[model samples]
Target: MSRYAETYASWRADPVGFWQQAAEQIDWFTPAKSVFNPASGVYGRWFDGATCNTCYNCVDRHVVAGNGDRLAVVYDSPVTGQVARYTFGELQDQVSALASVLRGLGVTKGDRVVIYMPMVPEAIFAMLACARLGAIHSVVFGGFAPQELATRIDDAAPKVVISASCGIEPGRVIAYKPLLDEAIDLSENKPDHCVILQRDTQLCDLTPVRDVDYAEAVETALARGEGTECVPVDATDPLYILYTSGTTGQPKGVVRDNGGHMVALKWTMEHHYDIKPGEVFWAASDVGWVVGHSWICYGPLLHGAATVVFEGKPVGTPDAGTFWRVIQDHGVAALFAAPTALRAIKKEDPKGTLIGEYDFSKFRTLFLAGERSDPATIEWAQEKLDRPVIDHWWQTETGWAMSGNPVGLGAFPVKLGSTGKPMPGYDIRVLDDAGNAVAPGTLGNIVCKLPLPPAGFPTLWNAPDRFISSYMAEYPGYYATSDAGIIDEDGYVFIMARTDDIINVAGHRLSTGAMEEVIGSHPDIAECAVVGKADALKGQMPLGLFVTNNGANRDESELERELVQLIRAKIGAVAAFKHAIEVKRLPKTRSGKVLRGTVQKIADGESFKMPAAIDDPAILDEISAALKAHNMIGEPV
Candidate 1:
C-alpha cells in the first residue's frame, strides 16, 4: 500500500489508538484513561477520563514555553483603518483579566455566557475568558435582528451577555448596544449582568442596574494584579454552544466538548493546512460562525500559529484588494475564504489585475469552503494566484474540515470539482435511498460510518431527541450528513447538493449544484444559483438565477440563450434547464452562502420569510422583480 493508504489502514485498524495519539499533541491536566466510550450515543464520548483547560492549552502553554514574545493574534480592520498585534504574554494577560472579571460577576463553571459582539479582538478575549473560567459561551453573530437574538437568548438563558457598542460594516456603523438592549427586552429569559465594551461611547447606552463597563472592569482587575487560574474540567465537559440552522428553520444549539475540540483542531492545523508554529494563519470569516471558531480562533491558536482576525468584508471595504493587502502586509501563509468571495473578486477585477499589485510570495495555499465551489472559480483563482486553491467541505456540526486536500499528509492531484478524499479521522461513504452503499459515480446520500470522529458534535443542547431524529434516524449505524454526493473511481467525493436540493424530474433525480456548475462557468456569468421550480409535466424543473460580471455590458437575452445552450450541451438535453434569468445580484447570507431555498420560494410565488441572516434583504426584491419579468410567477406573496 502507499504511504497514505498505509497510514489510513493503521488508523482504521485501531481508531482508539489513532485518537489517543492525536490527543497527546495538546497539553492535558490529566491524561485520558479511556480513548472513547461507545455507550454514549451518536458521536460517543471521546477522551473519557481526561481533564484539561482549553485556554491554558491555547495561551498559557505557549507563554510558559518561552514563546511569550511570539505574536499570537494580528487584528486588521479596514473599516477603522487600525491594525493591532498581540503576543502570547499580552493575550494571556488580557484573557486572564477578563476571566477574573467574569468571576467577579458571579459566573462559575458551566454557566452560559452569551457573547454578542463584532469581529474584534475583545471577542476573542471574551471567548478565551469563558474557556478559562470553564463557562460555556454561546456566541451569537453580531447585528442579528432583535427577534433572532432574543430567540437565542431564550434558548441559552446565559447569566452574562458580553457585547460592544457598535459594529462597523462596509458603509455604515451598526449600533450593537441598542440592538442588544432590544433583544434583552424581547427575550423571556433575561441576563443578570451585561458587560459592554465601549467601542463608541457616544453611541452606547448603559442600563444602570445590569451594565458594567468592559474597560473599567479589566483595568481595575489588572491594577489589582488579579489573575484567574485555568479551571480543569472533565473530557466530556461542555465547552461552547454554537447555534446552527435546523430543518424546522429554528436554530439548533450544537454542543462541543473541551478535550475533543482542542485535540481535533490542533490536528487540523498541521495535518490539513500544513501550518507550523508562529506561521500566519488567516480564515477570513466572522467569529460568530463555525469557520471562525475553528480555523480563526481555536485551530491556529492550538497549533501555536499566528491567527489573523480580519474585520472587513470580501469587497468594497476599501476595494477587492483588501484580502491580498492583508496577506502581503502580515506575511499570511495560509488563507481560507468562501468561494462567493472569490467570485466577487473575479467579477470586480475580471483580469486578475489587483493580485498583481500585491506581493503574495509568503502565501502558500488558499482554502475555500462554506459552499460548493465551482470549477470555473477554482480555475480562475489557481491561474491568478499560482497557488493550490483547495475546496474543503465540512459543517457547523463538525468542528473542522472533514474532507480536503491535506497537503501536509500527502499531496494528491487536484480534482476540479471534488473536495478531495475524506480526511484521515473520518470514515465516509455514499448511500442509496435504502441505506445501501451506492456504486461509484452514482449520486446518493452522504453518510459517515458509526462513531464519528472526536470533533463531531456530541449532542444538541437540551434537545438530544431532535439530534437523533435529524441525523441518526435516517440511517441505522451511520450519521446521515443530510447532503448528497458521489464517490469517483479514484475515491474523490463530489458533493452534489443538499438532499432537499435534489429535484426529481419525471422520476429522475437531478442536482441543482450540478446544473449551477455548468451555468456558472459561462464567460459572461459572474455567479449563479439553481433551484427546482414546480412543473406540471416534469415533477420539478431547474430555474437558474445568475449575475453578470461587473462592468460586462452584454445583451441579456443573447447571453441567457447562450448559457442555456451551453448547459444543454454540457449536461445533456434531458437536463431540461431551459429557464435562465439574469439578475443584478444573488441574495446571500453574511457568511457568503447563496440563499437558494429562499430564491426557490420567491420563484414559485410562495410566501417566504425574509431571513435575518441575509446580508441584504433588498436583494430579495430584485429576485422578485426578475421572477415577475420572466412571467414565472404573479408576485412574491
Candidate 2:
C-alpha cells in the first residue's frame, strides 16, 4: 500500500520504493521492463517498454474522455492588457496542426528544431507538437542576444527555426524576427525552414525571405486527415536538447530521452507537485531551459493537465502586481519562477503598500528555482501571496526536481534554508572527501547515490565524452552535482552554489576558471582573475580583474574596450564583460586558487578573508589601486 510522508518519521523509513510506485501514475502506452540501467553513457531508463505520445496524454486523453472544456490557458499580456483563454480541445487541435506544419517542413522523427519565441500559447503548441512527432525542440530564451542564440544553433544544428514577429512588455518590444535574422546570419548551421508567428501585427507584412507564415501552416495542418498511428517513440529515443547557460566553456548540451524524461518529469509532477487532470498548471519558465522542458512542456502535458503559458514579464506596465493579479485572475493552481524575479518584485512592489489585496485562495503550491531563494524572499512572498512558496532546488543537469519541498508525499517541516527532503527515489546523499556519507548536520558535497535516477543527461547529443566528463569523471563512480549541500539532522537537504567557484549569472552558469582563461588568452594580459559580484537583477555578474603586462602603454579606458571585445569574441556576448579593472596584482595564494570570495568582498566594499596560502598581504593594496582606477569600489550590492 502507498503511504504519505509529511514529516521525518514517515519519510525516513523508505523513499526508493515510494518513487518506484509513483512511476505508475502516468498512463504508459506500454509497461517498462526494467527500473534502472547501471550503464554510464545513457541516462537511466524508467519505463523501459513504455511507448506513449506526450501530447496524446496531455490533450487527447482529456478531450476524448469529455471531462474538459474549461479554460486551458489564460494568457495575460502586459502590453495590451489582454486576457485570452483556450480550451483543452482547442490546445489539442493547435498541437495537431502544429505537428502537421512541422512534418510539412520536413522535420521527421529524430530531427532537431529550434523554437525561439516568447512565453506564448503558440510556443507551447509548437513544443507539444514536437513531442508528439518525436522531433527534439530546443527553445532558447527570447531575450538572449544574437551571439548566444547562434551558439545554441551551432550546437543543436536544427533543421528548422521558429520565431514570432514581436512581443510586448513594460520596457520594450522584443523584435523576434530581427533578432532571429541576426542569429541566423551569424550561424553557418542555419535552419533550412524559418517559420514566423506574427503576434503584434494583426496584418503582418512578413519580409518575403523564405518565410512560412505560422498561422497559414496551422490552418493547413488543421485541414489534414488525422494520422492513423501516433509516432511510436521508444523509452530511449531522444526527446529534446535543453542547453544549459554556458558558463564554463560552451554550454553543456543536456539531452533528455523520451521514456526516462517523461517518467521523471511525470513522476516529479505526481510526487513533488501532485498535479491532477482538469487542473490549471502554470510554470513561468520560458520553455528555453530545462525547467520549461520538464515542467512547462513534459510534466503537465504528460499528465493530461491544462498548462498555462504566459507571455509577459512579472513586472509589467502596472508594476510588480502583475504576477499576483494573474494568479488571482486565472485561478492558477500551481506557479513556478526564478528567485531573481521574486526579489525584483519585492523591491518594486506596487503603489499603496501592504501586498495583501489579492486573493490567492486558489493558488496552492508555489515553485521556485533557477537560483536559490533567500529566507527573506520566501517569507515576503508567502506573506504577500498568502500561500506556501515551495522553494525547489534542482538544475538543468538533474533533469527533473530532485531536492524540493515536495507536495504531499513528504511535506516535511519547512526549514528556513533547506530545499526540503529529496523527492522519493532520488537516491541522494551528502558525501565527505572520501565519498562516504557524512553526518546529518555536516556540510559536504551532494551526490546522487547508487541505482541512478533517470533525470540527468542520458547522453550529450553528439558529444558523449563531453557528457561523461561533465557529470561522472570529476567524482569517479558517484554523479557529482557540483553543489555544496548538507543533509540536516532533521533529514532535510540544503544546497549551496556550485562549489563556490562558479557563479549563477542571471540564468547562465559561469565559472571563474573559464572566465579567467578567456581573459588570460589575450597577449597584453599578464594574468587575470574573475570574481562573481552580488547583483539583484542577474543573480551574479562576473567582475574581472586583469593585470596587464603593458599597463603603462595603454589607457585604462582603451584597455577596457579591448578586453570587452576580446571576451565577446572568445565567449560570446552573453559572457561579455559586465565590468573590468586593470589591476597590478591578483589576490592569489602561493598555492594558487584565486581568492574569488576575497575579490567579491572587495567588490562589495567589505572586509576580506585572507587565504592561508597567500604569500603576501601587500598584493591587496594593488587590488585596491586597480579598483580605484576602474571605479569599482563602494559599488552597491
Clash statistics: count for each candidate: 0, 3
Measured on C-alpha atoms, candidate 2 has an lDDT of 0.69
Q: Report lDDT (Cα) of residue 462, candidate 1.
A: 89
Error of 2 at 190 (Å): 2.9
Q: Per-model C-alpha lDDT, please?
A: 0.89, 0.69
lDDT of 1 at 76: 99
lDDT of 2 by residue, 1-637 (tens): 1233443233346433444565665556776665554443444555566676666666666777785685565666766766778887787788888888788778888888898877777888888788878788888776566777898899899988887887665656667777788888999898888888877443345656568999877877677744323576776677778776553357667777776666677766766787776677887766676777777766876776667766666554577777777777777788888765665565465221535677777788888876655565676677767677888777777677777776756455677656777765566878766777888866677887644566566667778888778777766766778887678776687775457756777677555655565665565655567778777677777888876553236677787777778778877777746677776666653213356667777776886545433435688877877776667776633
Root-mean-square deviation (CA) per prediction: 1.7, 12.1
- After TM-score superposition, what is the CA distance of residue 541 in candidate 2 from its true location, in Å? 17
Clashing residue pairs in candidate 1 are: none
**TM-score of candidate 2 relative to the true fold:** 0.76
- Candidate 1: residue 134 Cα off by (Å): 0.5
**On residues 580-620, what C-alpha lDDT tens digit does candidate 1 reach at each position?**
88898999988998888888887777887778678889998
